[model samples]
Target: MRHLIRAEWTKMRTVPGWPIALLLAVLATIGLGVFTAAGNHSSCGGATTVCPPPTTGPDGAAVDDHFYFVHRSLDGDGSITVRLTSMSGQRRLPDAVPGVRRVDTGLVPWAKAGVMIKDGTRPGASYAAVMATGTHGVRLQYDFTHDVAGSASRIGPGSPRWLRLVRTGRRITGYESPDGHRWISVGSTSLHGLPARVQIGLFAASPGALHVARADLGGSIETIRYSSTTARFDHVALEGAAAGGWRRTDVGATIDPDGSVHHPGAARASAGRYTVTGVGDIAPRVDGMAVEKTLSGLLVALLIMIVVAAGFVAAEYRTGLIRTTLATDPRPGRVLAAKAVVIAGATFAAGLAATAATLPIGTHVLRDNGNTVLPVSLLTDLRVVVGTGMLLALIAVLVLALAALLRRSSGAIAAGVALVLVPRILATTSVFPDDVARWLLRLTPAAGFAIQQSIPTYPQVTAHLVPQSGYYPLSPWAGLAVTAGWAVLALVLAVVALRRRDA
Candidate 1:
């Protein structure tokens, strides 16, 4: 092993431009960190207000926008009648917050006549809405609807409008289009209680400028598909109408307006916190996994180290160099062992260097994003984190053994990619309930992330929650273990293959 380490190191050190690459990696990492530590980096697109925006800022500085498109689920017995006039949201600020004042960007030029949007509250609805004009609209508005000053706009070509309404956590998507396949995205959105039949359409005042086209509503995905492929509200969806295309029903209820009863107004009268059990998420979205990137890059450096070792091992095999190497060292196993050592030492050094280089850059990136990994970081918990990194390099050694066993670069890379890529792809869907997805995802090469998870089983809701999904989703640690297990299994397979196969 020591001989192998020496041989590998000698080969890597002699390689042209190798040192430069290592230097660049280290410099980039620390430079980014220093930059981030010096600058102000907050959440994207929003001004860097403190932790929370102040409630009583200068006038017009605060704007709370709630756009609503209301509807009622229709019964098979009758046309589904619905209204849309008002929408509002709780101020998202510090605990002791108060509203500054009210403002309105009332009814657009396109909405149908007689329907005016104003401050009104609907019983059971969470938000105060601005809906159709007049007495009927007032009758529907709940008390909270008053003083919810906000502007409204129709889905238009100019506005690039799209409506995404979420009522009781269920999302609805709708669009207008002359062609069924091509659809327009809606702009005004509403958050009503569950079992809502949200009525939305395009209308005009004075002389009708807009014309009706078509409308349809399912869950969210279908609506998105329609809009992505077409224009906005060109199909002519009206906000308040007796016989429109959209409606919501009880979970198990049939789409047809059978004898099922319609839900009362859109809000919950006395609100309670809602929780959905077994709907867990696997977070730490890929973008945030900086340490994971470090591990990967280090592993790459390690792989290059392995290739260096293998090159020495094959020196005799290449251009009669192995013959001369064997003649000089004489002991086949001992010579091979020495080569392995050189490779391991060099690779581990390179790996460590790569890791050290990334740390500063990763720190800066996180800081610039106004986010920091917490509870722990790689520096504080180097054992587990470094262990993961070393494990990756060891994987490289095992692969190098196979390369020595195979002696062909194309064969090695092909075999490696073939083994690793599919598994990683499958693992992304690891949270899926399908048995195959679970079995397949767990068997990926990059399984170390299981340890990095901040939370186990992050709260994730499913698009469709059916009973027969599969073996339950694994906890984050368990999921990571699944990946590690695959790695161990692969190493074992390589070991056994090496022992059995001829070089």
Candidate 2:
């Protein structure tokens, strides 16, 4: 086996075009990635203030941490209770006349209001809350990503809801009640290191309203309109070491040039009743430019890899070198295996170098250009870089297998490229319906591209999660498995054919 692999490696290096093709693949990957990242730029805040990076939650994930908070300091073990009497929201609509914006009473489904216990006033602080949502009824959420359903009934003036949060050391428990008398446990979780002093508050928040429409040309157009939510809370009580009076803060509120809050949330207090209005969400960030957008040239790199791999095997057959190879090994299966290993190894190495360089360089360029790249975990980034290398390697192996079966370069290369690229193009270009597009991504080799997805589709957040938007139908590893399956099947067929047919 070692001798066979060494012989195959010698053949690859001696062929000048093969080596050049692989080099070109690497260059294409880096060149296109850097070019795309540099080309895309944004004028964030008109150069006065560059866009801030997304708020990172306690778990190190990017999160939306904006809301209206009316909090007071609490030391030691404590609990806060509030009765949400009403929930209302408004959405900005298209102007009826020039310079005249119109607004309508409405609510995005995820609008929230109730009691909260947070580590501090800072955005992305560790916290927990029990809230009444616009349409999801009552919910208990903590650390931005975790959510638990409390009730399915809606909140209104006629149907007020009572929410409570109790803190004991690092542990926090949430409960909901219909009449503030009978309570049901909603959920409980422990903050890894809860501080002795924390902020207990009543809060309100709403995410942007989204409208998606089918375009005449193709695909879908999504518009996110400004929206805000307001909630009235009364019968507020805090059971613990209560400090001074309540303090109001619009966490993550935008500031205008005059140093005034833009689209600011408000907290009003009167006779122990509070009305809080807030804009923005408190959840995992599901919208933004993903880090993988830099790797836009991967398709071009894959094409080069496929061509090189197919030609490597087909050239041997064309020049009648296969007979000598098999004559030395006397085992056709081993010879084919050697060729597959050589091509897979070469492509994987080149791809790894290209992607490893592209990700960081492209990310830096994007950040420099005032674009906010969504933050991902170090593990996820490593997976993307390594997964891309494996993806390219498997594709090269699949192409080599096809070349072995067909004994021709052009046919095999064409089949391999079409099998991978066509499905992706069709799915992303909206030539087919979204359902059909999802199926294409699910079953085709193009599914391997899911390995590049740095942002995941979150069920708690709403957005346009389609192929065109870079969201795949399958998980990253699962999609790679689909590609691997195809490669294994092709390799098996190629080995059988090589063993049975005359070389």
Candidate 3:
């Protein structure tokens, strides 16, 4: 087992052009991350990189980059002043009316840096403060240091009053340690009324800092020891439920509106505050935008990667190296597997590189357009990007299979290009309706690019418009599946041809 793993790992790591592949993967991952993290603003606004104070867009809607801002209390909440340094290079200002674009400092106490989520949202509201008794608005007296301005900022060394949330109804005695377990809490917050967005990190005062290194957010995979239904493991990979009917293995609690779940061992939540990371993808709190972009890019990037796959197998066939491969491996199936594995890995890694490289550029565009709403799970988004690259490797497999079956480099290249590229061109023209185009797009790279359509708010290359045309070209997963199906069908044909043809 050890030897097999080591051999595979070595081969996976040490391919001739592997370094370039890994570099590409990292670049693509980061690039996509920064782009989506900053909110793909170029798909958004004008010359402004980040939304300026009291800023409004051409759509007559004012855009704010920052989300949370509570006002200081009028009486008991005391006086609190919070200053935000512009890390986005430019900033967004808030306003009372959505269409009225004037940025007035007198209206917003925190200048152009605040957004009000209080009173179910009052006009021209900004700033957060913890009010003392007898106060109506949110406010905290005094200010902290703004010394730590970058991603790294340190708070405290004063009164370490922290807010913690905990579950006791039937969680796996779950506990999380932050900052490498330094600031540990076992039983923190008690579940109560109303769902809340509980977050712990850095807040700024005149003296406060934002020292953030490893923002570790983990969901417990508990053993389901009890349940209300016949627990099944065939649907998923689970180890925690070995001794019991453990309800939540990935997320916290899942319940139907009837106050029940697929099982009875399900845990309950406090208030309406859903445990997003603990729960499945119920909301945008855990966005897969980066994943969407990565997958879409992978579909496009795979078109480029087919060239590499062809170079390896098709060009080699042209140069007669494939005969040498047969001389060494003999078995067509084994050789095919080896080549496919190498190609898939290389393409996946290269996709990652593309994602990372695009980060700085994407970030610039996002901030310029004023869309800086980053999700909590940035790393997960990176994984999606990496997956897209892997999808390209699948594309390579199809290309390699065609190369082996035909044993003609030029013919295989032409077929591969036709399979991947032509549909995108067709989709962009007035050739088909949106849905019709989507189904037909499966014939080209556009199908795969559909993975990047996380939101319905993506551009349409198709000329004719429909009801949901502006939303998503195709669902991301569905698009990937379509592309995968094409690759698989091609591979199956290649296998059949290889088995029958004389080497």
Candidate 4:
């Protein structure tokens, strides 16, 4: 096995064009990524002002993080209960057309304020809470992106609402009550690995913009700037050995002045009662416009790799080198495997270096251009880098297998490139609708591109999540598996073709 790999490596290096092709793959991937990144300017007016705030979805990509919080650490099992006296907000109405009824102001449905238990003060942490919303009534929200509605009772100046969050071990239960004493369970969730110490607090946040369709005109949704929510909390009480004196810290947007509409007032305590007000989100923003948007270059890189991999094996057959090489080693399968190992190894190395370089350079360019770059965990970034390399390597191997079966560079390269690129093009372009595009991606090797998707489609967020909108229908790993299955199947057929037929 070792000798076979060494021989194949020697042959690969001796070929002048193969090495140049690998180098081109690296340059094209990085160059295209940088160009795409540099071209993306921030939509927010300027860098000095926080135009697009940070908020995130379930996948932890930053979305909109404008919110206010007043909290304290709870080191053990505990519960926090508070009476929501009133919740109010103003929402912008769509532009009025002549002769049509002009709607001016209304409450944004998801504007929220509630009692929460969070892993920490950081955005996108694992946590759960029960809250009263502006127009959506009551909800049980967990893990920054998941929302479940509770009682249908309306929240207003005349109607008072009570929210309670109880922590028992790793499980957290949320309850709502018209009066503080009697509780109705809203929802329950387990925050796995929640530490003994966590931030349990009061929070308020409203989406910066809401999209509302004009009543008179269907299929036209207008984006409206949402007004902030002011929630008055009284009779705030905590029960647990670890819950005592509380602390308050602002997360993303700063606390506003006392008289301001967006003021996130400091919590005041007197006579076993606490009052706190906040205006922004405690969740991270989704910045889908960054790394995920710059993937056009990856397709170019994949094309380069397909040509190189197909030619690698087809050249041996073209020059009648396979017979002489196999004459020395009677086992044909070993030779095929050795060739695959060499191609996969070199492609993985080049892809990894190129992808790693592209991400940081692209990110710097985006920030310099005044674009908001959403933050992801180090783990997510590492997965993207490694996943890209694996994707390229798998595509190369798939091309090599096709070349083995066809024994013609042109035929194999064309088929291989079409298999991967054509489906993706059709899915992304308007030629196919979203559902058809999604099905093509699911059934074809192009689904591998899902590995590059960073931003998740959140149920709470109203944005285009189609392929053209920079979102993939499949999860990252699942998409990779689809492509891997194709590669494995091709390799098996190639091995069978080699064993049965003359090389």
The best candidate by lDDT is 2
lDDT, candidate 3, at 17: 62
Count the clashes in each prediction.
Answer: 63, 0, 75, 20
Listed per candidate, the RMSD to the true structure in angstroms reads: 18.9, 2.4, 20.9, 6.2
Question: Candidate 4 regions off by >4 Å?
Answer: 43-63, 67-113, 117-128, 132-139, 142-162, 167-173, 176-282, 292-296, 429-431
Task: Arrange candidates by TM-score, descending.
Answer: 2, 4, 3, 1
User: TM-scores for all candidates?
Assistant: 0.40, 0.93, 0.45, 0.73
What local distance difference test score does each model get?
A: 0.34, 0.89, 0.38, 0.77
Off by over 4 Å in 1: 1-8, 17-47, 51-316, 328-331, 371-384, 429-437, 448-503
Worst 10 residues of 1 by lDDT: 222-231
Model 3 sits at a Cα RMSD from the real structure of: 20.9
TM-score-best of 3 and 4: 4
Error of 4 at 199 (Å): 9.5
Model 3 per-residue lDDT tens digits across residues 1-503:
33333443455466656455445545545554554545554343675343433322222122222222212112111111111112111112333587755321111112111111111122222212221111111222111100001111212232112212122221111121223224232222222221232111112111001121211221111111111111011111111112222122211233577876432222232432111111111111111122243222333455556665765666656776656656665556656666676667667667656755664455455555655433324544564455556556666777877777777767777777777666655554445555555566555544765544433331111112221222335566777777788777777777667666635
Higher-ranked by TM-score: 1 or 3: 3
* Candidate that beats the other on TM-score, 1 or 4, i.e. the better one: 4
Local accuracy of candidate 1 as per-residue lDDT tens digits, 193-268: 4333333222111111112222222111111000000111222223323354333212111123676532211211
Per TM-score, the best of the predicted structures is 2
